[model samples]
Target: MKFLKIGDRNLLYPIIQGGMGVGISLSSLAAHVAGNGGMGIISTAQIGFREDDFYKNPIVANLRAIKTELQKARDLAAKVFENSKLTAKFLDILKNYTPFIGFNIMVATNKYADYVIEAVKAGADIIISGAGLPIELPELVEKGMAVSGNEKRTCIAPIVSSRKSAKVILKMWDRKYKTTADAVVIEGPLAGGHLGFSYDELNELGADTMTSRNYKKDKYDAEIKEIIEEVRIYEEKFGKKIPVFVAGGIYTKEDIAHVMDLGADGVQMGTRFVTTYECDAPDDYKQTYIDAKEEDIVITKSPVGMPGRAIRNDFMDRLKSGPIPIRHCHNCLALSVCDRKTIPYCITDALCSAANSDESHALLFCGSNAYRADKLEHVEDIMLELTEDMN
Candidate 1:
C-alpha cells in the first residue's frame, strides 16, 4: 500500500481506524492502530462517560478526558514499540516513527470549538471532524495552534459523504480561512453511528439490502469517484496533495483494493476494528456484532437529527412503539439538532449503556458489514490482514 502523507509525515499504511464514540475507540484501540502504522483516531463523542462527574458535569469531564486519552494513547503506542513483537518492515518504519493519534471531534457536539482547541493543546497529531459540515474548522484549528504555542500545526480533515459536500467544505475553507483540508474522508451510506446520508437516499442507492449492495454494484462508488475528482480541483488550487480516504463497509483486503482502484488514497474502517481485542467497547457490545446477521442490521432515526445504521436489538425494537421518555439531557449534541423534551431518547444515555455492556437498552451503532464479524481478533492481526498483500 502507498503511504498516507499528512503534512510532513508518512503513515506506513494508508489505513485509518475510523473513530467510534461513547467509549468505543479510545486509547487502547487508537494506540495500537498507530503503533501498527495507521492513523488511529479517538472519538470525542461523550469520551468522558467513564469519568466520575460525567453525568454531573459532562463538558468538563469530556475536556479533561481529551487530554488524558491523548496522553494515554501516546504512552501506550510508545510501549508497543518498546515491547511488542513487530515485523521487520514495521521496525524499519519505526526508525523515524511519529505515531499519529487523532481526535474525531464532531461539529455537532455542544462544545465543539473547545474540544478542538483542547485536543490541539493536549498534543493531538490530527483532528477529524464530521456529524455536520465543519464550516469553521479551519478557524478553530488555527486558534488551537496559536493557543498551543506550537509551531507545528495540527493536521485537520473533514468527513464528507458526497461530491457536493466536499466542494462546499473545500471552497469555504479556502475562501474563509485561506486553507484547505490536509486530507478528506468520504463516508458512504453504509457507515455506522450517525450517517451523512438520509434514509431515503440510502434506500435509493440500494444500501438497505446486503445482497444488493456489493462493492462491485455499489451506486455510492460513483459518488466516491465524483468526490475524488472534486478534491483533485482543490488539490491543484492549493498546490498540495489533499489525500482522500473512503469509509463504510470497507472490511477486507479486497475492500481496500476496490476503493484504492477508485482513486482513493486510503481507507477508513470502523466496524472491522470494533471486533478487535484492542477496541475499547465492552465485550458484550463487541459480541453483538459477532452474533449479528445481515437482517439484524437496520437503519433508524437518531436523536441527533440524522439516520444511523445499527444492530436491531431490544432497544431498537422498543423505539418502534413510541419515543423513549427522556430522563435527562447530557447536552452532548448541538441544541439545534437535539432537544431533550422532543428527542426520542437520550443519545448519550443509550450510547453509554452500550459502552457499559447494557446492550438490551443501548444504541449499538455499526456499519453494514458488522454481521460478518464471527470472532474477536487482535488489532495487529486485522491490520496485517488488510495490508499484507500491499507490502
Candidate 2:
C-alpha cells in the first residue's frame, strides 16, 4: 500500500470510505477510518435528521450537528494517537495530520453554498461535492476558506463520471476562479445510492433500465483511464498533482489492485463499508444488504432527480402506482422547484426512515455489489481484507 496525499495531509492507506448519506456514515465510521490511516468522510446529507427540530428547522439542526460530528471525529483521532508509539515515524507524522476528516456535501442541495461554508467553518479538512456539476464549487470553497481564515486551504475534490465533466470543471475553476481541484473522484454507474450517468447510457451498457444490474467494471475503465489523462492536463496547467480515486463496485483486494494498475491513486468503497459494525445505519439496515439477493438490487429514479441503486422493497413497490405526495419537506435540497405532483416520493422521509431502520417503507439504497455481502464485520476486519497483500 502507498500514501494518498491531498493538500498537506498524507493518508497512510490509499482508501477513502465513500460518504453514504441519510445518517449512514457519520462520526463513528469516519473516525475509525481516519484513525486507521485513511480519509474519513462524513456525509452531510440530512445529518441533522435526528435532531429534535430537524423536521421543523432542518438547516439549523444540520448546522449544529456539523459542529458536533466534526468535534467528535477530532476527539476520537486525538484519543487514538495520544502519545502512542505505534511506530516512531508513524506517530511523528500522525501528530501533524488533521485526522483526515472530510465532508461530503451534495451539489444539488438547497442552500448549497451555506453547507459548503458551514462545513469549512467547522474545520473540515476536505470538501467533496457531487450529484450535479459543482461549477461554482471553487468560488464557494474559496469564500468559505476566506471566512474560515485558516492558513491552509481546505482541499476540494469533485465527483465526476467522465473526462468531459472533469475537463469542464477544471477549466472553469482555473480560468474563472484561479483555483483547481486538489483531487477528483471518478464514481462509476455501479456505485450505491445516486448515479451520475444518463438513464440511456446505463441501459445501453446492458444494465436494467429501472434498476442497474450486471454492470461491469471493465466497461467503465476506459472512461476512467481517459479521465485520468484529462486530469493530468490540469495537473500540468496548475502545477499540482491532482490524485484520482475511483469509486463503485470496489469490494476485494484484487479490486483495489486493479484500479491502482489503471492509474488510480486509490479506491473509495461505499457498499463495502455499509456492512461494517461501525457504520451509523441501524442493524436491520445492515442486514438488508446481507439478505439481498442478486436480483433484488435495482435502480430507480430518485426523488432527487437522479438514478439511484437500492434494494427492492415494499416502499419502492408503492411507487409503481404513481408519484407519492410529499407530506412534509425536510428541506433536504435548496432548490424550490421540487413538487409532490411530479416527484416520486419525499426523499428526506424515505432516507430518514431507512436510516432509522424502517426499511419496509423506506428506500434501501445500495451499491451494485451490495448483494455480495453475506455477513456483518468490523471496519477493521474489512479494511484488513481489502489491503492484505495477495503476494
Best by lDDT: 1
Q: What is the lDDT of residue 354 in candidate 2?
A: 97
TM-score of each: 0.96, 0.94
Worst ten-residue run, lDDT, model 2? 80-89
Tens digits of per-residue lDDT for model 2 on 50-108? 99999889999998898899899888866644532321246645556555888999988
Give each prediction's root-mean-square deviation over alpha carbons.
1.7, 2.4
Which regions of candidate 2 fall more than 4 Å away from where they truly are? 80-89, 92-95, 209-213
| Highest TM-score against the true fold, candidate | 1
Q: Check candidate 2 and list the clashing pairs.
A: 109-334, 110-333, 110-334, 210-299, 211-299
lDDT of 1 by residue, 209-262 (tens): 442243334578888999999999988998988889999888999989999999
**What's model 2's TM-score?**
0.94
Provide the global lDDT of candidate 1 against the true structure: 0.87
